[model samples]
Target: MTEGDGNGFDTMSRRPPSRSIIEAVAEAEGVPAHELRPPTYESLHTVIDPDALDALFEPHADGTVRPAGRVTFPYCGYTVTVDADGSVSLE
Candidate 1:
């Protein structure tokens, strides 16, 4: 689990098991998943560059994406974080 603020964010036991970070965040936030849109990690230009995010988090051959890092930023008044295993946390 990730170590984050206690106000609202909490570490997930495992990967969110969703197709997209947006969907994962929506589910965690208790809002409709459609409200968030992410074509790739790059879709969030306000937090990080699209191309750079893709390069950093894109899946590898055989459809396996396991990064050695994580990304955290704010979105729609929530603190959004993405982990190496595609897990997502919302605060």
Candidate 2:
């Protein structure tokens, strides 16, 4: 695992998440969860918005609506789809 010390970038000596984290990500993505596949670590770091990605993890904090991993921002109606491989494909 890599750790950032409040800087642009840094490295850490921690291990990555287990298979369960993948399952949790899948569940958060609203898919079969178990069927969801893990994405490459590099891909995971490519997210443009960290907060937006976190929103995908635990969308609801205190029972309030939150943005999905995939989203159509500034639009009234639309749907977002987050693939198992951590790919965001829109329709």
Q: Pick the candidate with the highest lDDT.
A: 1
TM-score for all predictions? 0.52, 0.22
- CA shift of 50, model 2, Å: 3.9
Across 42-91, the per-residue lDDT of candidate 1 in tens digits comes to: 34556656466556666777777675778877765567766776556666
Clashing pairs in 2: 1-14
Q: Judging by TM-score against the true structure, name the best candidate.
A: 1
Model 1 has an lDDT value of 0.57
Give lDDT: candidate 2, residue 7.
21
